[model samples]
Target: MNMKRNSVGDKVFDCFNLTGLFILVGLILYPLLFVAIASLSEPDQIYNAAFLLWPKGFQLESYRIVMENPDIWIGFVNTIVYTVSGTLISMILSVLGAYPLSRSDFKGRRFFSFFITFTIFFSAIGGMIPLYFVIDKLGMLNTMWSAILPGGVVVLNMIIIRSYFETKIPMEVQESAALDGCGNFRLLFSIILPLSKPVLAIMILFYFVHHWNAFFYALIFITEKDKYPLQLVLREILVNNNLNNLLPTMTDQNYLERLKQQQSLKYAAIVITTLPVLVLYPFVSKHFKEGLLVGSVKG
Candidate 1:
């Protein structure tokens, strides 16, 4: 078989496309690269340079400081707890909700699905005040449950899972399982869940990342410093510049030095917070595109 040859215009287009993609990649990557470099670079050197391609006057002081901070460690633990618990709750609720809606024979499936989707739009229309009042009425304010329970089921994620269940899993397979004396719970746990790993993996990744990075809810609900998640703690450092608690008391002589170190500390905190998501993506990435494509297409 003969392969089609590229015309001159096609060749030019390919070159331009490749060039544009490379530039876009660079634009995306450079900020992350700069942050990583800045975390290691000498604090003074960071401000001195216009653009960083590499670490300047490398030092481990910023990392050492971050690691030594008890609050960072506390925040790290709190974040892990919240992420794991919240993700589990979200996934469980989403799967339970999605599975029922996916079944054509399930009564009120359309009504329930429409109701869930309606909440999404309602949520967009200044729902935060109502939600806060609900949380308060439930007496969950200033507790971990406030952060975890309120956003337990994301409508869009549930919709994706429902779409995947409807389109990917054939009705015959379910009927066969039923005929073989499988109960609904058994079939869901044994057969449906096992076959739905790709979509599940993607959903887990989505929920995990969201919980890991979430801070707004934490900020509103958690008043105690100890209860703050990693992102909330990071917000104090990066947004509020409240490092006095993190840093040791400084004498007048070294106050300027400590101030300079704050720059590196900010970058170091960013690296630490972002590292988990970066590490996690590679594991579930293979399922990401296929799962998202199939799940979204039908819905």
Candidate 2:
């Protein structure tokens, strides 16, 4: 009877603990919710502070202005290009590098691994001028390959992938493949990569987010506004002193209305930038915990 009573008390405590955790999370996330709601609220009501939780007067004007800017669409396209291309490149290189590092029999493998790993600890702090000089020397400036080639592989992601391959892929299986006339490329593509879906998914998510949000590279290498990524375009609109790009067509009264509208649209643009990862993450989130743990383990 006492045990049963104790169990009941424990259950009640657990329930309250969960509820408190949720309330705490809600408190933290409220600002984001408020920003989202405020973005859609009416300009007059926003200025008046009449709306708190709900939008006082709903308006799509901010989005309309944001959409009207030609650069925004161009930047969106560029961002898509950069993200997709960069992610593919990152995955290919990381996979190739990690697969080799997973093997102990490869000649000078430890030396090679140390060589590759050396870049992670060091910081390169030179600005656009030095990078520009190097790119110019290579004659890659103003080219699409400029963006694609510079950051093709991320060292940290590669380390995670290599760890996963080392821990998860059995040495006996690889040895069997070797005996059966399977070469490095065939074993990697046909065996290793196929079984590394979880870690690969996590790497894809990481590289995708990195490439999508990258602006400094584009800002320096891409002189053409047509090549500007979405982040750069957003920076120009929000941080840089260039309001004319989005607000050029607005008249005096409409300009005031538009400026107010942009205040909300800025948040909406953030939501737009953030939306893809949110959508992609949930579908692959199940693998994240397993992949990250397995892929990053030492042994």
lDDT of 2: 0.82
Candidate 1 regions with alpha-carbon error over 4 angstroms? 124-126, 251-255
Q: Which lDDT tens digits does candidate 2 get at residues 58-143? A: 88777777778788888888889889989998899999888888888888899988888887776443666787888889998877
TM-score, cand. 1: 0.95
Report the C-alpha displacement of residue 159, candidate 2, in angstroms: 0.5
lDDT of each: 0.90, 0.82
Tell how far residue 25 is off in model 2, in angstroms.
3.1
Q: Can you give the lDDT of residue 189 in candidate 2? A: 93
Q: Candidate 2: lDDT of 293?
A: 84
Model 1, range 5-43, lDDT digits (tens) per residue?
999999999999999999999999999999999999999
